[model samples]
Target: MTVRFELYSTWGCHLCEQAEQMLQQAGLSGQYQVLDIVDHAHLFEQYRVLIPVLACRHTKATLGWPFDQAQLTAWLQLQLQED
Candidate 1:
């Protein structure tokens, strides 16, 4: 089964772009939705300061910014193991 995820981000953010690139490089593309926090007040409040957050929809688990490829991989592994 495919895992679901969401990426909380806003426009004009270089970090968000970089995070997206990392997601693609990590072979996680097309399995997630990209949500622009600016369009939703609640999401904005929740992730305003953490624009590049990657979250598991089912578990509500989050990975914030400043993550490298290894960390991203490890996080994904942990999420998979949890299932």
Candidate 2:
């Protein structure tokens, strides 16, 4: 099964950059899209502290920030299995 991870991010977020690097190191960056929520006020406000959130494309299951390789892998696997 293919998993598409979407990360919500914005400019000036060092943590978001770090998360991107982590995903790349884990070889998962190519499978995801990093969306900048700065232009979307509601999204920006809602996700300011929640930047770097990961979400499944098909099911929309959300995983918040401060995640690592294992958590991301587990979340992706769970989402795929649910589908």
Candidate 3:
């Protein structure tokens, strides 16, 4: 299945873990995929310091860290509307 969102992250990152939990709590567990930046050279370069970035595949929109569930939901709504 094609995922609507991509979560850029890496291992051993507390914030990244929290972001995953947030996604789960927001009921987006299946609509997204977690991508390890370490496994992709360009992603590593772009998100090394910006781990836990949430990107919408459909609209190419991104939401960085420090986001709560409400913010995430709002972003998703915006992206869906854009699509």
State which candidate has the highest TM-score: 3
All candidates' TM-scores? 0.91, 0.79, 0.92
RMSD for all candidates, in order, please: 1.5, 2.4, 1.1
Off-target runs (Cα >4 Å) in candidate 3 are none
The candidate 1 region of ten consecutive residues with least summed lDDT is 1-10
**Candidate 1: residue 47 lDDT (0-100):** 89
Cα lDDT tens digits, model 2, 22-43, are 7787677578888899877987
Quantify all predictions' global Cα lDDT against the true fold.
0.87, 0.80, 0.91
Clashing pairs in 1: none
* Model 3 per-residue lDDT tens digits across residues 1-83: 45899999998999999999998888887889999999999999998998789999989989998898899889988998987
* Clashes found in each candidate (C-alpha, N, C closer than 3 A): 0, 0, 0
